[model samples]
Target chain A: MKFVIQRNQLIASVQDVMKAISNRTAIPILTGMKIEVKNHGITLTGSNSDISIESYIPAEEDGIVNVEQIEEGSIVLQAKYFPDIVRKLPEQTVEFEVDENLKVTIRSGKAEFNLNGQDAEEYPHLPKLQTDDSFEMPIDILKSLIKQTVFAVSTMETRPILTGVNVKLNQDKLSFTATDSHRLASREITVKADGINDLNVVIPGKSLNELNKILDDTEETVEISVTNNQILFRTKHLIFLSRILDGNYPETSRLIPEQSKTTIHVNTKELLNTIDRASLLAKEEHNNVVRLTTLENNIVEISSNSPEVGKVTEEITVQSFEGEELKISFSSKYMLDALKAMEVDEVNIDFTGAMRPFIIRPENDDSILQLILPVRTY
Target chain B: MKFVIQRNQLIASVQDVMKAISNRTAIPILTGMKIEVKNHGITLTGSNSDISIESYIPAEEDGIVNVEQIEEGSIVLQAKYFPDIVRKLPEQTVEFEVDENLKVTIRSGKAEFNLNGQDAEEYPHLPKLQTDDSFEMPIDILKSLIKQTVFAVSTMETRPILTGVNVKLNQDKLSFTATDSHRLASREITVKADGINDLNVVIPGKSLNELNKILDDTEETVEISVTNNQILFRTKHLIFLSRILDGNYPETSRLIPEQSKTTIHVNTKELLNTIDRASLLAKEEHNNVVRLTTLENNIVEISSNSPEVGKVTEEITVQSFEGEELKISFSSKYMLDALKAMEVDEVNIDFTGAMRPFIIRPENDDSILQLILPVRTY
Candidate 1:
């Protein structure tokens, strides 16, 4: 492979593919980044057991040449040094050349690097996932959907299926659900899925997190395709593929409480800050649990005690309260995470009882719901 | 004790003193921050075995009131929670009240934190060092001096004295020298010490690093007092006290070669970048050693080889070169650190031979000097 490429474009594409590269991969060849040169552009691929990423730099786009002197070939270079070498190159353009013996030479300005390249044939080829179910959504919306529900996924591997977020598409409505049993987060968005099959897949939370990092917050559309085992998130010039978890996701619709005995609407930021301060002392406790109590005159008291470290209490007036007076304790960390995910100014919380799970959602919208299982506290 | 203080000021002061507090201290009381209220101001103190810092918040300054409703008393609060609590308080002003039993109540807006406070009497008081061996210098210069030399201090505790930077004052010149026995960094600045006594002291590199972090880069004068066991750096509202390391520092002045067999004057940034790229493959080696070979026409080749990772060579043209041609190998990290600290456009490097120590100094200035011993390589 011989190509002279714009350093900035190469750096950007290398960083994008690097997200999927893992040094701890069991497959030795997977640790190297595969570079394939073509007349159209150059493609870089990096992969681990969970996800694989391919980023492309077009030879010419908008009359600007990103790559030239292209010789159609392929080589795999060590991921460790290739990225750093490209990043620190002295000039705006870098030239890459590979000989038949697999010796790769990278030159820029007066500097030159001779690296022993691995045979590209040894690198596992990511099978082109053949699927008819494909849909498009704005990149920003996809990133938001991932962020809102991914944090609630179970970090513990005790239930391996719970480590992934459940994505279900029923006709035009697309929803994501994540739960670790202690807390749950769900968000829904409407997508034009005309002629698309009813899709149900669970993507690993870790993979989603990496995808989010690589994706820029733009309104550009991203085409998503799902297969029996692999899911692909394809942009204009980049492709992200993640393996689907092999298990049946639990049915979570019935877990939502039918009705609430008490409900309160509060400013999202005020409640978040109060819980954060209260948790300062609660951090040493079992779950960093803090109790919320309804008081007279639409006011609620949030308190936490660590006996050895002292206690904290904060009273915030809610926008509205009704039904019954209640005292409930839940993990402050869970509440904080849930509050942060909701970008709305006001959130209404519905409580079934002290011992049951409660739901928090935007006061005006039901699209985002955060549910927390209250701790049994005296 | 009771006082209402501006949240911003309180937060800044707390952060400053918290630098001295360590949870791993053998003395339990040192883990708590001591707050003492006086008529003129309130003082926050945090101490570990090596250092203690006192940050004072005056009642009023420059017609602005930072603290009000001050009642005289003192108490020690857990450092872990106090800083976080103050940072996340709900209001612009935080009111603090302490009872006789050391129950501390902190109120901000509708939020309140009741924390258990320790007796101030139990907190070990930092001894006020009595010494006439004192002088003043611009804070920015002092900070620069520390940064230029402190990084060279030995991190290993095998020779504990080498872990501290040798600070010396003779007549009017104040110089700081640090070395790990392989590479040495030394910087000097002139201070007004006409009446101050000559002094030599070794200050722990860790403490100096913390002190540098707490100090803002300003031209304001910092009064420094040196005693046998402790050194004091006092600014307008902050006093940083660090314990002086016991033992005499080894003489390092003789290590710098007086005559050079080869000298190369190069752009500091160009050489730094060249060394950085050359070190990419060198990182897998023992000391990240890179070779510099002077060629004809003032061209110098920088290269490194990792048997398994391949090699890199970059030839950079120097501005000027004199004396005999030379080839030397040294740690790229040490060279990078020295170049970054200089902040100069060009540097003159003097080499005695391939095996002896070499010196790098600014082209037209001698205030800062960096010396490195070449590594044995075939």
Candidate 2:
């Protein structure tokens, strides 16, 4: 492969693919990134077993990229060295040339480097998924959906399927659900995909995390494609593919309740701060549990007691209250997560007895809901 | 002890003293902060065996502080809990009271906390040092002096003395030296003092690091008092005490030479980048060594070769040359450090010989100097 590319453009593309390359790969060849130069542009691919990323740089981008030679060829260079070399290049433009024996040469200004290259044929190829099922959505909405529910996924790998977030779509609505048995987060959004059938897939939470880091917070649309086992998300010049878990996701519909014995409306910030204070003491306990009690006269008392560490009690005034007064004990972290996911200023928390799970949602919006199972503090 | 103080003021004092308190202290009382309430104001102190910090909050500070009680007493509370509790308090003014039994009550607005407090008498007392030798200097200059030389201290504790920075005062000049034997960094600054006496002390690098974090970048003068075995630094309302290491500092003055055979002047930034790029390939080698060779046409060549990895070569333009052309190889990290510490745009390097040690300093200034021993590359 022989070509010349801009410093910034190459750095951006290399950074995207570097996310998929792991330093601890058992297979030595898996650590290298495949580079291909054609008439159109240059394509870089990097993959582990779980996720794969492919980035492209056009031959001409707003007069930024200029390819001097049209030599169509491919080679695999060490991903670890390529990015560092490009980032620290002393010149504005970097030149690349490959000899007959596949020895790659990179030069910028007066600095020159020669790295032994491996045949690109030795690198594993990503399974090409048929674009039979594809959809497009705004990048902002997708990022928000992932942020709200991905954190609640089970980090323990005992049940491999539970480590992923389950996505369900029906024509016009998309639902995302994540639960670790103790706490659950669910969000739904409406998209403009016509003539698409029902879709269900389980994507690993770790893959979404990597995707989030490279994604810029812009209003551009991202095209998503899925096959039987592999799913692909394509943006302006980047493609992200993740392997899907093949298993039946648990039925989470029966977990959320329809009614509650008591409900309280409180300012989201006020309740969040009170719980944060109580957590300082409760964090020393085994479950980090804090108790919440609804008192008369529009007052709510939050208390956490650790026999070893002292006790903390706080009183916050709620905006309004109705129904029977109740007392509940749950993990302080769960409460904090539920409060943070809500976007509205005021939140309404519905309690169904002491032991039953409770639901929290924004006072004005019903699309985002969070549920937490109370801990047995007896 | 009973008192009410502004939250921000108390938080500031608590953070300042918390730096001295260690979580893994051998003595239980050492894990707590001593709080004393006097008729004039409140004082907080935290101490480990190596260092102690004390901060005072007066009864009234420009009408920002208010004291309600004249009670005078002292108690010690767990340093880990008190800081978090004070930071998360719900009111602007927090009320604190300790009974004769050492039980503490902290109340602010509708929140209350009851914590176990130990008698102040159980806390370790700081050593009293006689202030016979003292001097004062600008805090900014002192901070800069510490930052420029502390990073070169030997991290390995085999030679305990080398783990500290040696500061020696002679006549009107103060010199700081640090080394791990492989590389050494030293700088001298001029200061005015009334007494005519020479002094030398080795201060632990870890303590200096913590002090750096707490010292603000201000032009105010700080009074420094050196005793037989301890040093104390006093600012407006803060007192910092550190135990000095015992033993004599090695004679590094004899290591620097007064003559040279070759000298090269180059832009500090240009040479820094060249070494940085060379290190990328040299990193694969065990020593991360790079070679620099001066040519006849005011040109410098930087190169690194790793048998298993690859090789890289770069050239940097030099402004002027003197004496004979020379080539030397050394750790890239040492050269990078020397360049970073330089304040002037251009630097002059003196080469005693091809195998002998070399010196680097600002072209226009003589206050700072760096020396590096060449590595024999076969």
Candidate 3:
């Protein structure tokens, strides 16, 4: 295989595919990136046991030539040093030539590198995902959906299914929910869809994070196809495939409280800062718990005390307060994560009781909700 | 003790003293920062076994008030979290008040932090260095002198003295030299002095690095005092004291060749870039060796070949070449370090022969010199 391509274009494609490559893969060939040259363009593929990523660079896009003198062939090169070499190449354009024995030669300016390439045929073939249960959503919306719920997924392997975010689609509405038993995050949005409904799939949170990182912030559409055990996300120049977790996601709707004994509306930034300061001393304690108490005159007091490291207390004025006065203690880290995901000036917090899970959401918005279980402080 | 200080001033002073604090110090009190509130100002001190740093925040400097409500007392606070707490305080001015029992209360805006403080009596007292051997030099020049030679210090602990930079003063001239036995770097400058002649001392490279980090990049003069076993560097708001290495420094003057068979003047930047690119493949090999061959017509060829990873060659045009033709190989990293330390547009390279040690210096300057030993390539 022989091809000459623009350095920037190649670097972009390599980075996209590198998201799926991990250093500790059991399959040796999986650590290499498969590069295939065709008449139309070049495709770079990287895969681990859980996910596969393919990024394509067309011969010419928008009247700008990205590749020239292309010959059709394929080889897998070690992904470890390929990205660094391409980034540090001297010239704007780099030429890659592979002989019959898979000896790859890369030349740019006056510098030349010959890297040993493995036969592409040894790479595992990605499963062909074919299903009518597919939907399309804007890349920015998908990225937001992943960010809002992925952090709540359980990082422990005791319950493997909890490590995946439950993605469910019914007719025109799509919902994502993740819970680590301590905290839960859920987001829902109306999306344009096609042939199927009542579809449920649990995608590993790690895979979703990698996918979100590669997705651009543009409003372009990303076509998502779901099969029995595999899901594929296809964009114009990139394709991502992930294997679904092999167990039913536990029902989490019952965890969120429907009624509240106390409700308060507060500026998100102000509350976030108060909790951040209160957590300083709390972090020294084992549970990292900070307590919030509603006082008279619509004021909320946040405090944390460590026996060995002193204490911290912060008072913030709330926008409004209603119902019975209440106090709750929860993980400061969980509260911060929930607050950061809500992109709003004001947030409405609902407390059921002192020892129950409470829900927080953007004021007057029902699309996204975060629930945290309060820790009992003796 | 009680004082209200500007947040920025407190942050700056804390950062300056933090250079001397390390978590792995054997002395438990060294892990804490000693804060003394005096009639004139507040002083913060951090010390490890090798070095001690004290930074003072005056009550008023240059007609600006940095502290108010000062009460004379002292306490030691844990250095691990002090910097973070001060940086994240809510208000522009932070109030620090210590109770009779050493309970420290820090208040800013509506946020209040109470930290447990240890009695300052347990903190080690800094030694008083009253010496007639003293010198004054621009802080910028001192920083430059440290940077020019510190990189050559041996990181291996086989020879402890080689891990320190030998600093000497003769008459009014100050010189600094460092070497790893394989390569050497030296720099010198003349400075105003008093009662210091033929004084030689070895300062640990790690201490110099920490001291260099805290020094401001201004032309303001800094007072330096040297005794038999201790050295003190004092600026307006900071005092840094470091213990000298207790061993004889081997003579490195004979390493630099007095004669040259071939001399070439080239742009420092071009040669650096060429060697950087050539080292890409060489890095994959163990030695990281790159060879430089002077061709006919004032052109230098830089190349490196790895048995398993092909080869790379780059040709760079030089300003001039004299004497005889020569080819030499050396560690690319060492060459890059020597080139970067020389803040000059052009550098003159002196080569004795293929196997002998070579010298590099700024085209017409004698203030700094670097000697690098060539590697034997079969």
Candidate 4:
């Protein structure tokens, strides 16, 4: 294979695929990126056993990519040294030529590098998914959906299913849920779909993180297709695929409390700042517990204590409150996480009891919610 | 002790002195900063047994400070938590009060903190140094002197003296030298200290690094005083004192070659880039050695080779040359450092032989010079 491409265009695409290149050498072939040239464009794909990313550069575009010579062939080049060489090249265009035995030569300006290459035939093929159960969503909306709930997913290896985000698409509404038993985050949004197809696939949280890093903040649409064991996300010239976890996800719909004996509305910024100050003293504790008490006038007391580090207390004039004069203790870190996920000025927190689980959500929004179990503190 | 100070004023002083407070608990008293209130001002000091810093906040400083209650007393407070607490306080002015038992209460807004404090009598006082031998220089010049040559100091523990930078201030010029036996970097600058006493001292490189972090990018004057065992740097409200190494520094004057048979002048930036590119291929080699050879018409050829990782060659045009054609191999990292230290458009390299030591300095200036020993490569 032989091709000459613009430096910036090749660099942008190479960076996107480099994220999926395997850093481990358990399988030596997995460390190389497979390169293929066709009459239309050039494609670069990197894969491990669990995830794969493929990006394409068209031969003729809006003056971004200029292809001088294109020979239809394929080769696998070492991903480690190839990207560094391209990034540091002193010229605006890079020339690539591969010999019959797969010894690739890269030339730019006055510098030339000859890298040992592997046979592209030895690389594994990516599974092709049928488009019968595909859906289209705006990239911005999809990015927010992943960011809002992905952090709460269980990172431990005990329950393999909880390590993935559960996506449930029914009719025109789509829902995403992630939980680690201690806390849970859920979000629901509307998307456009062709036929009535329900997808209840569990995607690995780690793979979603990689996908998030590669997805830029653009208004374009991203088409998603799922097969039996793999799911693919295709953009303009990028394709991201990940293996699905084969297990049953827990029913999180019942985990959120339906009733509350106490409700309080406080400024999100004020509560975040008060919690941050209290955390300094509470951080030494194993659970980082902080207590909150609502008074008659619209004032709430936030306090934390440590046996060796003293205690901290501050009063925040809340917006509104109802029900009994309530006092409860919970993990400061968990409360901080729930507060950060909120996007409005004011947030309402619901309390069922002193020892029961509670829910936190934006005061005006009902599509997103966060739940945390209160720690027993006397 | 009771006083009220502006938040910004207190924060600035606290940050400067906090540099000497080490996190290790091996010395318990060293973990706290000593606070002393006098009729003139309040002084705060922090030390780590090796270095001590004292910053003074005057009673009336251009209407920035307002001392409400003046009680002449002293105390020691924990350094780790005081800075964080002061930074997060909700008020513009912070009130500090101490009880008979040395218990300190810091009040800001409606929040209050009671911290355990120690009597200042137990804190070790810094050695009093008379200003018999002092010199004044521009802070910018002093900072530049430290930054240009400090990175070459040896980090090994076997030879503790090499871990410090040797400073020699003569009648008209001040010279700084640092090395780890493999390579040396030296820089000199002429000053206006005509009648100043000649002095020589070795200061720890780590202390200079901390000092650099606190120095502002202004043309303020910095008064430097060298005592028998301590060296103090006083600038405005900050006083930084560091313990000097108690050994003779090695004489590096003879290491610089006085004569050269081969001299090549090239653009500093061009040479730096070529060395960086060639080093990429030589990274896996034992010493990361890159070879430079003089070609016809004064063109310099830079190349590197690795049997298993291929080779790279780059050609950079020379501005001028008055030497025999020679090929020399040296550590790419050392060459890069020498080139970086010379702040000039073009540099002249004096090479005696392929295996002898070489000198690199600005083509127009003779104040600063960098020397590197060539490595034998077969």
TM-score of chain B of each: 0.98, 0.93, 0.98, 0.93
Among all windows of 10 consecutive residues in model 3 chain A, the one with the lowest summed lDDT is A279-288
DockQ of each: 0.89, 0.67, 0.70, 0.54
Tell me the number of clashing residue pairs for each predicted model: 0, 0, 0, 0
Winner by DockQ: 1
Off by more than 4 A, model 1: none
TM-score between model 2 and native: 0.96
**How well docked is model 3, in DockQ terms?**
0.70
Show model 3 residue runs off by greater than 4 Å: none
lDDT of 4 by residue, A31-61 (tens): 9889998978899999987789999889987
Worst 10 residues of 2 chain A by lDDT: A61-70
How does each model score on TM-score? 0.98, 0.96, 0.97, 0.96
For model 4, name the residue pairs that clash.
none
What order do candidates take by TM-score, descending? 1, 3, 2, 4
Docking class of 1: high
Query: If both were scored by TM-score, which would come out higher, candidate 3 or candidate 4?
Result: 3
Best-to-worst order by DockQ is 1, 3, 2, 4
Q: For residues B1-378, could you state the per-residue lDDT of candidate 3 as single tens digits? A: 999999999999999999899999888889999999998999999998899999999999889999999999999998887898999998999999999999999999999999999999999899999855677889999999999999999999999999999998988889999999889999999877776667799999999999999999643988888887899999888899999999999988877788999999999998998888888878856478999999999999998887666677888889999999998999999999999999999999999999999999998788899999999996
